[model samples]
Target: MAHKLTRLVPVFAVDDIERLCAFYEKSLGFVQDFRYGEPTYYVGLVKDVVEIHLISTSSPNARQPWGSGYLSLLVDQVDDLYRRLKGFDAEIVVLPDEGITAYAIL
Candidate 1:
């Protein structure tokens, strides 16, 4: 017998869990699904079919290096999302016409 895999969730190690959650909610429109730990050591967010998890980290060095830990999201309206992110003052690493890729830090 073979085991079947279910959903896949990407976890981001962030220095500030609350900030990351707020960013996803405010910038990307992802809703907060759940949060764990008294100090919020873990969080889950969902938007459409995509789900993202975040974990609080005390050490910044524990986080992935710059340009790494990238997550690719597929949206219904690429242009609309691009504009929303830009409107939020997000860092647009790649232009929409050039294959949309954005990174924002709060």
Candidate 2:
């Protein structure tokens, strides 16, 4: 039998854990699942069964260590989610194009 893949959870390194957590909780409706660290350097969030992990980094003012990556979320209503996010001040790089099935934010 072929190997079976289960759920996927993406981890992102952020400068500020609290700020990112706030964004995910308030903006995306994710709930805080767990946290760690003295100054709170690690965090986990969940929406439904999907999990997102975040790690705080205090690196100098340089380029991110991770070259490039992005997360793609498939929602029931993409247009509604897009409209809801429009009220906030997030950088939307890719809007739903003719060939694209989802919008992207950076």
Clash totals in order: 0, 0
Model 1 TM-score relative to the real fold: 0.79
What are the Cα lDDT values of the candidates?
0.77, 0.81
- Candidate 1 local Cα displacement, residue 20, angstroms: 1.0
**TM per prediction:** 0.79, 0.82
Locate the minimum summed-lDDT window of 10 residues in model 1.
Answer: 97-106
Task: Mark the regions of model 1 whose C-alpha exceeds 4 Å error after superposition.
Answer: 59-67, 98-106
| Lowest-sum lDDT 10-residue window in model 2 | 57-66
RMSD of each: 3.7, 3.6
- Candidate 1 C-alpha lDDT tens digits along 16-90: 888788889999889999988776788899999899988888643346547766788865777777778778888
- Please name the candidate that would achieve the greatest lDDT relative to the true structure: 2
